[model samples]
Target: MTGKERRARIVELLEGAQAPVSGTALARELGVSRQVIVQDVALLRADGTAVVSTSRGYSLARDARPCRLLKEHHRDDEVADEMYLIVDMGGTIEDTMVNHRTYGQMSAHLGVSSRRDVERFLDDLRSSRSSLLSGITSGYHFHHVRADSEETLDAIEQALREHGWLVPMSDYEREALR
Candidate 1:
């Protein structure tokens, strides 16, 4: 099949999928190299197809309606604490976004769907010796979450705040939540 046809299929798959689709899986389905899949996805995005790329893979950007902001503050060290908060509230960390005081906004694609995903993500970071987004921010980070209700999202925010993993919206006031 042609690249265009493959991309269309990918978009269809992403639209129907309940979770992010991995690059390897997409490559396998299309009988193409993973790099080619990546390039195709990029091209699709460039054409404004609403395909949001996350660290886990690709997901179609289709929020049901009524835009909601799920805000939370968390110290970097308290990742597990925040993860529990999300899991308990029937929410998952959709993405991790950061704003460097110097570098503007930086984001990492973390499609953390479960506790195991969180653990694997952390383990990968450790094994790869990757650098944290901001060294100065005292373990502070933000999560874009998807949940059934606003209350659940608020509960996550509250839990993160209680654990001191959450940073206040003031000071630098960088929005960690989205």
Candidate 2:
């Protein structure tokens, strides 16, 4: 098949996927190398396809959930709690962002919508012994939380507030954190 046809199939697969599909899996399905799948995904993203890369794999943003920006702070050990609170409240932790003095803004895709996803992420982090992006900025960071409804977002915010993890920083306050 031509590259254009392969890309169209990739989009179809992502759109119909129930979970994040891996590059290897896509390549196998498309009868192409994994590099081709990766490059196709990059081109799809550059062309404005709503593809999101999570630790597990890639998925299309088919739901179009409303997103709210939240600033939070917690100990590294409590990252799971912060993530669980959101996913438990029917929200997806879309990504985490931190502003570093040198790096400006850096964000990591989380796409965590359930406890299982949280556990997997925590496990990987533990195994790799890698520092979190927020650790660069002293355990303070931001998340673009996506929820099925506004009420769900409200509940997640309330839960975070009660958990003492919500920092609620304004534009000026965020600068102060740096």
Candidate 3:
């Protein structure tokens, strides 16, 4: 199929998908290379399509949620607890961001919303030899969380604070939460 036709097909396929669609799967179905699918996806986003790339793959962006940036600190071993606390309080851990003296700001997608998701994320990090961003900044970092409501977010903040994970939001970091 032509490139335009292929992209149309991609939108159709993703529209009904129950889960994120992998680029490899899309490429195979469209008889194109994965790189081409990636480019096509980029072009789609450039055209204002709401496709989000998750760890699993690509899925259409859902309606925006009420999200907040929370600063937290903990040891490496306490990572799972922090994640669990947020998810258990009806918060979806959208992503994590950290500022580096050298790299400026760095971020990564987490998409963690459950204990299982936290476990998987922890396992992947351990098995991949990747270090947490918090490690770079003395256990200080931020999480963008989508909660069911402001009450839920308040509860999450309380829990994090009670557990001694809440860090004071700095003036430099406050603006970025928006």
Worst 10-residue lDDT window for candidate 3 reads 42-51
Off by over 4 Å in 2: 1-60, 172-178
Q: In order, what lDDT does every prediction score?
A: 0.66, 0.82, 0.82
Candidate 3 residue 77 Cα shift, in angstroms, is: 0.8
Best by the TM-score measure: 3
Runs in model 3 deviating more than 4 A are 1-60
What TM-score would each prediction reach against the true structure?
Answer: 0.56, 0.64, 0.66
Model 2 lDDT per residue over 16-65, tens place: 88999998899999999999988888656533356888988899977677
Q: What is the total number of backbone clashes in candidate 1?
A: 8
Candidate 3: pairs in clash: none
lDDT score for residue 43 of model 2: 57
Measure candidate 2: CA RMSD: 8.7
- Indicate the residue-level lDDT of 157 in model 3: 92
- lDDT tens digits by residue: candidate 3, 1-178: 7776787799899998999999999999988899999998875653334588998889988745677788888999999888988888789987777777786666677789999999999999999999998899998888878877888998999889999999998786674333
Indicate whether candidate 1 or candidate 2 has the larger TM-score.
Answer: 2
